[model samples]
Target: MDDTAIDYAAVFQALPGMVALLTPGLVFADANTEFLKAARRTRDQVVGRYLFDVFPDNPNDPGASGMRNLAASLTRVAATGERDAMALQRYDVENPDRPGEWEERYWSPVNAPVFGPEGKVRLLVHRVEEVTELIRARGGPTGGRTRVLEAELYTRARELQELNERLRRAHAREREVALALQEAMLPACRQVGHHRVAVRYRPAVGALNVCGDWYDLVDLVGGNRIGVSVGDVVGHGLAAAGVMGQLRSALSAASRVAMGPGEALNILGRYASVVDGAESATAVTTFIDFDDHTISYSSAGHPPPVLVHPDGRTEFLDQATDPPLDACPDPIPRPQAMTDFAEGATLVLYTDGLVERRGEDIDAGLARLADSLARHREEDPESLADAVLLELLPPGGATDDTALVIVRL
Candidate 1:
């Protein structure tokens, strides 16, 4: 019991470690001078204190471990003593010397049974060392520091996953809206008066979705004449497609009530100005008449129709069209522009998406469009529309929209 007591004191005190004696409840019982300095508190302040009680919560700190059931974990280790020698705990410790800032700490906890006078285990000895600098040098969060890092990473990962999911849903919604609008706006195969009409409608080249392009054939004046029309609403996607549907309905009704294409378009423009809340300012119209003979007719502003002559020659009837619809109220109707339709002749009604280009000259593009029709003049109206549109429309899809109506007399 008294073997070299003076030497033992000299060696243990100067051992260059944070040595401490702790009760079973983890309260400080005794400590070396090094231990007092590391805890950043003197013996009077720390001797009887519990570990967590000294380190109170800091509300704004992200490194703080929230609520943990450490009591159970600590109890298990203490009872078994299986992992006591090799036990380690990591935590975020507010710098004991400096308060708010935290550093990672690793505690290599060694538990030993202290014997009483009866040779039975009466107390536990917990030796501690402040390894915050060592852990920082190794680039790790230890003790409470590790828990803090884990919490921050978990929360960040959850937020990132949620953001990705939200983006996916937004894309899906846009696709659905575009699809529904296309179905509602595009023409379906149907007849105009006695002429059995077939409609083939596709979105603009490159766009892969519906734009303001539209086509329609109306039974004019109760089967006396068939009025065919095609127009492009300015813009892209759902907004333009919506306007196309409105114009399609109005154009059909207007043509049916009036006697000729010119008068019909004039009335259409008048009504459009009233019904069109915003688009009344920008609307284009072109008309087609088929009654045994074909006449290329236009009203308001629109791309002129390409006449595929009975003699297999195609020409763009480029006389200036009247002012665009809805710009003025009840505008005067000009004489219906006429082009004689041979029995074998086909008339191509198309929106400017067939010819317009961003970098290329507009007139040359139109001429090319006319030339393309002439090349494909021998093909059936349905086949002719396809071939010409594919060639003249070029690449990158329809930046605007396109509509095509072919009338073969």
Candidate 2:
């Protein structure tokens, strides 16, 4: 009991490790400064407290009693004078100061009893280590291990970014190639009997990579008459865009000699039918011929053009004379039908991509397109046509390319 003996009191009070000398009862007898710091308590608060009273419950526990086990281990060690060890995996303990976060802790314990002159166990020396840092080090990579893992992660992230960039570039290149092919195949404005006319063509959204819709307007007869054609090739990307160009050119050449819609489409279809690459080629075309006050058109497996009378009446023209060109040799479109274009009549030609949507049936899409065109017929032909296109197709409705042209008489 003297202060000068081995200063067991001073030794226990100053040890760096979490040191606590307990009685055989597993009750706190005396603890070191380090133990108090780890416990976040002072001797006045911890002395005489049972070990199980302060031991926290396990979070990943099976509802087994860990607190009681620790007390039993303490009693067993004190009785046997043997050393023991146990691991605390992520024992949930909150920093009283920073309650927002919890800490991970691990413990290594050993309790040994000292003997007195009477030869019975006199004092139980309980030593503990706050192996928090050691456990964290074990959980994470170290030195070269950390570097190797970091290198692998960095490499994986870089590969992902590189793949993303490559995909974007590929998409852009596809669009450029499709557009360039369409532009190259398009014929310059020509006279269809005597009018200086031009054409309009638009590709669908991602279909820029493979535009399927196309149009051609010609001023035949040296600017005396006008001829127009619209078509959809059964594909996307380069193949569709290429077919559109071929048809537009074929129409330009055929219309010079034959100004009738049925004849022009027939001529083009025969040429396509005899061509090789059947698996990769098929097209539907609608041709229209317009003079001073008359209009005639023929369809070949393509959507019919819409004609709006000056009196606000609308006509949907989908009755085709033949199946899509290229299905067989010498597909003949029926005789073209003639209609009078009074002062206010306007003809609208477009591909289905302009009027169709994913979840909608063909009838609904067609009806909506007709309704939209009627609402905007009072505007200039170009404005009316553009308005109708935007309304029916909206920004994303047509996944493929679209082409539209409006003629006012």
Candidate 3:
């Protein structure tokens, strides 16, 4: 053989899955065509560059361990002058065409050190077998005992899938039941004395979980005074809805005999603490005196009501705030706040879900609500309520259940 004149680069490039020669300083000395193809790069882009700079870890993925694991394997191979084999790794790579997008990949890597005449490590030979397809086809790692384990895993996975489908159907049925219960308990929009009332109830977007948000309007004391209540029970699903039903019934019974908003909330709070799983509920109760043309209200850690005037003025009723119901075993008297009720004024009461958004301060949400109300202040009660919802929670915007009541007196 003409050993002195032989082209060793041709042999290195030809024999490979994906192979790269790294210098002692972890700089890429050379890489095969297969390595460049897998990296979505060219020879000019990869050669003579630091390995990490050429192929950095995916920044968006916090669990990306490819660079760290490969570096450790190379270091071990260089220090001990022995081969280092790594297990399957979830290595994400950035798309060359799409910036900030990562493609998921798996690799089985082996690092072996090359020695110089002095018996010191000179270059590290890194080889990677792209086993992403193989692992996915086998549904897991495959080896000597994997065939038997894979069969068992396949059987268990099918059984689990069937079990999950059954559970999903059961949850759907429960959600339907809860929705029916909620709809039956909710009062329809109607005229209460001289005022026109409108109500809206929307379930949270996505999923079959039913939440515990409700609104009510009841005539108080000889049908002259009216009581409006909006409450949200903590959590969701069947348990929360059941608690909401209990609270609604208790509040209705208490409002009949209670003197005002403060007394009504105080009674409802005491009743809520006794009900199972109802301790963390929050509410707002308001009483309207038609004869006196006045409005008195109280809150139990709930969002304050927004009062919109006929002439396009708006104000949030933030005073007389108290802790959520059942926050204390023996609750204190909820103080009441009163304001003049103009003939054409509209009062808006709602659950927090109507205004709250993820990653935003509640104050911002309130400001948005106020702006929406001021924009639609001239519309009728039903149209105004609908407009506010469309503005705050457009399609696919709500993450929690929402209940809203609008009263135009």
Candidate 4:
């Protein structure tokens, strides 16, 4: 048989594992049926697209290393003309039927460089074997292994278990550090002027819950005016916390020189647009005037502030609000809503995490908050804040960070 007569394309297509040929520039040259099945993509969808553009990292999870590791491996293979095998990686794939939805997948990959007749790297061969099910099974026990392979399987399982344990410990340590950093950045709840203030911050239950929920109280230049704010940034981890700190500091500074709540929020919205890595944030800022016995507040896509009257009647100050900071290209004027606060009345400000749940409607959460506030209307500000958190969040923990602020006249 002539070697030139062999159908290389047929042989490549018959391979069981996922395989793709990439050009020197990393464009998809050819992909086998297995590769198409694993990627959930057609030849037309991926053939001409850049590798990263076709399969980018998960936007919501900044810690995902699949794209980074794959890129590095390809670059190394191109430079050294050698095969590179990578460890297991969590590479999420987008659902073809549902836009913006991702499905979790784990893969072990190997990259080998294909050389041209000129002795230069021309094409790259990439192969992947999915092991997501095997990994999930290894966490528990498995049955029906032959005695000959039992020892080998047991050793491999033990190694995987140890790796998972180490990852868990590392995540725990990271959570601890992030919590401490968030705590150090947040402002302490204390009295401002004659108004009594109390604040509560509860981070989410798991290791990944450390986020950018923040509340702050700022004393304006005038003794009779105080500024209060609560905000939730878009993502989690140190990046979100850092953006929260920057926005908090900017809001505080703006409160000192700016006229009122609307002006402060306008400044914050403008600043958020220029800041790097800031996608968007929701915030509510209020200007409390003791001399006037009134509260003026503005919201940037945040939940409405709740007010409890001296008679225990509760009202949500829902008003026409602008979009969240950094959410849009053009800036819109933030409108301030004014309402009178009677003596002994209380006001509550909180992030969406205080009210939002996985399957529950947000309106229901807000209604529950109002009910909780009305029930604890007679308590002091400190006690009222504590009661609300205890009632809503309970003991175990919430799925997202919760920040609450209560002010009593």
Full-model lDDT for every candidate: 0.62, 0.64, 0.83, 0.83
Q: Which portions of model 3 miss their true places by more than 4 Å? A: 1-161, 190-195, 207-209
Shift of residue 282 alpha carbon in model 2, Å = 7.3
lDDT of each residue in 1-409, candidate 3, tens digit only: 8897888989888876899999878999999989999889899988899999888899988878899999998988889786766666668778888878988777767778899999999999998877555445444444524644444455466546645765787777787887788777777655365568888888777634457887888888764689998999877667778888888888877888988888889998888888988877999988888778888999999999998888878888878889988997988888989998788888999999988988989999999998998888878888998999998886875879898999887
Model 1 C-alpha lDDT per residue in residues 37-135, reported as the tens digit of each score: 776667887778875565444445555442132333334444543223323345455676676776555554444556569765455555554444443
lDDT string for model 2 (227-326, tens) is 7777777667776666666666786788767757777767877776654332323333333334357666777667777778766678876554456767
Going through the candidates in the order shown, the clash numbers are 12, 23, 0, 0
Q: How does model 4 score by TM-score?
A: 0.61
| Candidate 4 per-residue lDDT over residues 337-406, each given as its tens digit | 8989898889899998889988889999998999999999999988998889988885788878888999
Each model's TM-score? Answer: 0.59, 0.57, 0.60, 0.61
lDDT comparing candidate 4 with the true structure: 0.83
- Each model's Cα RMSD: 19.2, 23.3, 20.9, 17.6
Off by over 4 Å in 2: 1-147, 170-172, 187-202, 274-292, 318-320, 330-333, 395-397
